[model samples]
Target: MAASACATGLRGSLVSSFHGTWGTSMMGEDYPALIQSVPRYVRVGPPVRSPPCMKNVNEGKGIFAPAVVVTRNIIGKKRFNQLRGKAIALHSQVITEFCKAIGADGKQRQGLIRLAKKNGERLGFLA
Candidate 1:
């Protein structure tokens, strides 16, 4: 019982001390405006062109603006397959270049691929 009481008091003090460390200035208007004014540090990819059907619906919806904008990728099976094809092509090119750089023959390249697959399984990446 005494040990439990000591634990409760310690936890209460920790919570109170944490609460005390948060300053009221952090909630000030200037602080929020400053934070908002600072641009976000994240990768910005080019927006995909809208489809023909969507283009007709989007006409005259807003005033013409000349600023750059970034958007997330489309979420659909068609888009996924397109991106996957590109990724696979890139992967194949990289592996082919690496094998060529090491002067590996066809048989040696096959052996290397098998070894890589085995290692991936051992590392739980291909499991």
Candidate 2:
């Protein structure tokens, strides 16, 4: 009975403390004024333009982008891009064949792609 009364008293005190002027003093009356003093919109300068050399730079794309970029640097851009396109087509064909062999559907194929992406990220290929 004493324990129950103590619990009730504690609960009541907690409730009262929550409902009381606890946080009001901490915030003070200038809280709203301080909030209103802050400017909503900030002025930004004009967009910066990239240099000519940086402008035409191809950073590559997809999960194999980093490797593609390295290969692109090794081989010339035009030739590398052509080869990359053909290689991508061949890779897609191979993946399609493998999927067919395993009886994997579109969803399974997507899962495989995601798994490959995850593996690539783990292997620092995405970096």
**Maximum-lDDT candidate:** 2
TM-score (all chains, Cα) for each model: 0.31, 0.38
Q: What does each candidate score in C-alpha RMSD?
A: 20.3, 12.4
Summarize candidate 2's per-residue lDDT along 17-109 as a digit string, tens digits: 344385886687888998799897754688777776633222343466677568777888789768856765676677778999989999988
| Model number with the top TM-score | 2
- Any runs in candidate 2 off by more than 4 Å, and if so which? 1-70, 121-127
* Span of 10 residues, lowest total lDDT, candidate 1: 64-73
- Residue 48, candidate 2: Cα error in Å is 13
RMSD of 2: 12.4
